[model samples]
Target: MKLEALAVYEQPLKWFALGLGVCSTVCVVQGWQLAAMLFSLPFCLIWMYSGWLRTEPQLKYINMLFSVLYVYGIGRYFWLQA
Candidate 1:
């Protein structure tokens, strides 16, 4: 990707990852498990994207693990409710 494109992509991902992380935390604190799970989905993806842009191995792996955890949370939320 071009420098400009990468820069643009990096900015939103940073803001979004932060915003979604906070939002997800709030959802859980408010006793909204499903909402937290849903919110974390995008948060993890944006984090992973940011990691990719910066070529950060640790960030990429951490976010990848979080994404899996989010997916499991989503599934468990529904599974237990049914």
Candidate 2:
């Protein structure tokens, strides 16, 4: 895709990620660990992709780490349930 197309999506994607982060926070506060991690994973992934697109190493790396952690948390949650 063109840079312009990516640019057009950037703001909306950021907003969506922010919304997911908020939902994750609310889930955490409500003691819904699995739901929180589910929300967090996508939030992190979105930020990671956004960071990669913007060439921001810090944002990318941090979000990548968070994404990995959230994935682990999600798997762990399921493993424990089983």
Query: Roughly what TM-score does model 1 have, to 2 decimal places?
Result: 0.81
Q: Which residue pairs overlap in candidate 2's backbone?
A: none
Per-candidate clashes come to 0, 0
- Per-residue lDDT of candidate 1, residues 1-82 (tens digit): 5644766767767787788889989998999988988988998888787787778899899989989998998888889989
Best by TM-score: 2
Q: What are the lDDT scores of the predictions, listed in order?
A: 0.85, 0.88
- CA shift of 70, model 2, Å: 0.6
Give each model a TM-score: 0.81, 0.88
Cα shift from native, residue 15, model 1 (Å): 1.3
Model 1: pairs clashing at backbone N, Cα or C within 3 Å:
none
- What RMSD does each model have against the real structure? 2.5, 1.8
Q: Indicate the worst ten consecutive residues by lDDT in candidate 2.
A: 1-10
Task: Give the distance in Å from residue 77's predicted Cα in candidate 2 to where it truly belongs.
Answer: 0.7
lDDT tens digits, residue span 17-73, model 2:
899989989998999999999998988888887887789999999998988898888
